[model samples]
Target: MTVPERPVRVLVCDDQALVRAGYATIFAGYGFDVVGEAPDGTAAVRLARELQPDVVVMDVHMPGIDGIEATRLLAGPDAATPAKVLVVTTFHTDENVYEALRAGASGFLLKDATPDQLVEGVRTVAAGESLISPSVTRQLIGRYATRLRPSAPAPADDGPLAVLTPREREALTLIARGLSNAEIAAELVVSRETVKTYVSRILTKLDLRDRVQAVVLAYRLGLVSADG
Candidate 1:
């Protein structure tokens, strides 16, 4: 029999002791290792740089250096080996959420999210997947859709992504909109397995590793608008 892999290492950052303990408890139950905790962004950054954790649960607003800035320092384009940061915040305001994501957070979670939701968010981000609440993502897109600039034109339907079929293209659009596979199946009125197949075809045709890159490419190619 094969032995199980090691648990994902997580760093929790929050100003409140109780909040940190709460997350520690939840993560412990899910078989994750809570390797460190920091009460502010400055310390958080230090711990992250030292530990090189698999995931960092960041609180966007904190005293001294804020989480967004710290995230930029740790996970932004310049990092030597970036760690995924999951922004956990109480505020759902458009500016707060957008700023956190723009600062290079791989995912976002609400402070009031259920225990299972919190655990799943950590796991998903650790697995290189983005997990934004559909409701929150939709609201953000709607509010800031017009601010997005137009994408450069695709070359008369010829490019690296041309191998995808019409159905696969549809699936890609929905994926960029952050729809889950089950949701896509319902929207297309097709079986879940059918939707899965289409998604697989889209990924293979485009050579994308996961949905996050698909989302970025959709916006870049104008396949999915900011409003979407």
Candidate 2:
């Protein structure tokens, strides 16, 4: 007989008690392990460090420490061992979204997303994928393009991007433009599996956690203007 698969452990962080309860119910209904819930970012960081859940569903505007700072503590470059963070945000919180992205968040799920979408977002980040929808991503990033780092690391011969093969680099550009694997396959006239392979290789070579960082790098390289 096969052993049962382990449930994905999730930590929900939001200021509102109702929101926290709602998320917990949705995740529990999906058979996910709702390990912990925090009413504020301060508690979020503390609980996450102790429980080490597989995914953290974070809110942007919590009391005490904001979600962006909490994310930085949990997943930032300085984090000794980063936890995957899925930031739930609205379009009005674009600045927080950008900051959270910079702080090493794995992906974004809109606040108004359906219960199914909520579970899917957590699952995506838990599986080491990012929630980068083409239209929404371009809109969010383009609005704050100036906040992006001005340096173009992709062009530098000795930079991290230089380590990728030509095809891998091409895939990275498409990914940056927010193309799904299927869309990328059509654009490049390759199989979807082939695009997936390229994406995996590109991330490995660049030492990136997911497609969000890849998109950021591609923008820095000027591969796509991509305003939403």
Model 1 stretches with alpha carbons more than 4 Å out: 142-146, 151-168, 182-213, 226-228
Task: Give the TM-score (vs. native) of candidate 2.
Answer: 0.89
Candidate 1, 204-227: lDDT as tens digits: 778654565466667656676675
Tell me each candidate's TM-score: 0.80, 0.89
Residue pair clashes in candidate 2: 139-228
lDDT: which candidate is best?
2
Tell me the RMSD of model 1 versus the true structure. 3.5
Lowest lDDT sum, 10 consecutive residues, model 1, at: 142-151
Clashes of 2: 1
The sequence of per-residue lDDT tens digits that candidate 2 reaches over residues 1-228 is 999999999999999999999999999999999999999999999999999999999988899999999999999999998999998866545667678788999988778888888888888899888884323556576545535647543453446677888788778877876777899999999999898899888888888888888887776666666562
**Reference-based lDDT, residue 39, model 2:** 94
Runs with alpha carbons beyond 4 Å of true place in candidate 2: 132-135, 142-146, 151-158
